[model samples]
Target: MVREVITYPNPILRKKSKDVEVFDQKLHTLLDDMNDTMKQHGGVGLAAIQIGIDLNVLIINIPLDKEGSEDDGKQLDENLIEAINPVITHKDGELVFTEGCLSIPGFHAEVTRAENIIVEYFDRQGQKQTMEANDFLAIAWQHEMEHLSGHVFIENLSFLKRKKFEKEWKRYLKENSKK
Candidate 1:
């Protein structure tokens, strides 16, 4: 099921998500629904809070060809990754890139993130795992990690840029409301 993505300014998006304790069928279902929702919105990632679920869960699926491949030169059989209660243990270097969120439709901003990072989290199978990510994958991790902490990419923008975005977002909402 593709759940409705809660947009920006929604209270849920500002609230920190809770950690997933019992990795049961319900968690599986949520992950499945999130995956569907992200794909439906043509997003590279989706967080639980984006769908009004205050859980520390997020899915990231970047096509290897699009992101310039993962850390390894070899292509991954499965690029769709589910991170539950993720923690970034290490970060190195930095790069600025334009990022967009499914929740904040029609908005994109330049955000500086680590060029490489080591993340620890539980996979969909309930197994603890840790891996290093670089390049676009690292940026994706940083983006989703912020969502778990109740922070959005817009927060990284300058005050002027954010104000402009607010104006644009309001206009977009009003225009869409008429339809």
Candidate 2:
């Protein structure tokens, strides 16, 4: 079963995720939960902080699993790329695309992101790896990586544009309040 992703304006998103010093069953559990949560929410990626876990762990399986690229270049369990202490080391080109966060729910905003990026982080096994991603994959990386830094997709919007989504956001809040 998948877990519901926490939404924006939740204090968890603002708190920087802590480094995962232990690569054990707990970390594996988080990886599983993150993947389940992301899949359930129809999100390509998910961050630990988004799920209210302050750990430097994130799962991404976007353009990758969608295109069968998960079969190539260093296999990870079921295409779930768990990045601990992830950081964007380099970026190039730019692409603006609609983006939404599980935390924010019900709303997506047009946001500009690097079309290509070089990211550095540790794999779930505690091995350091740097990988390059482009197009949709890069966007997914940026989105999830931002969560590690205590930022949400809403922060990508302009003040006025963000205000425009208030009604829809409010509706989500109202509906969720009963849960």
Q: Which model scores highest in lDDT? A: 1
Scored by lDDT, model 2 comes in at: 0.81
Q: How many residue pairs clash in each candidate?
A: 0, 2
What is candidate 2's CA lDDT for residue 116?
Answer: 96
Question: What TM-score against the true fold does each predicted structure earn?
Answer: 0.92, 0.86
The Cα RMSD in angstroms, rounded to one decimal, for candidate 1 relative to the true structure is 3.3
Clashes of 2: 2
Tens digit per residue, CA lDDT, model 2, 111-144: 9999999999998788999999898789989998
Best by TM-score: 1
lDDT for model 1, on a 0 to 1 scale?
0.89
For model 1, the run of ten residues with the poorest summed lDDT: 68-77
Q: After superposition, how far is residue 31 of candidate 2 from its true place, in Å?
A: 0.8
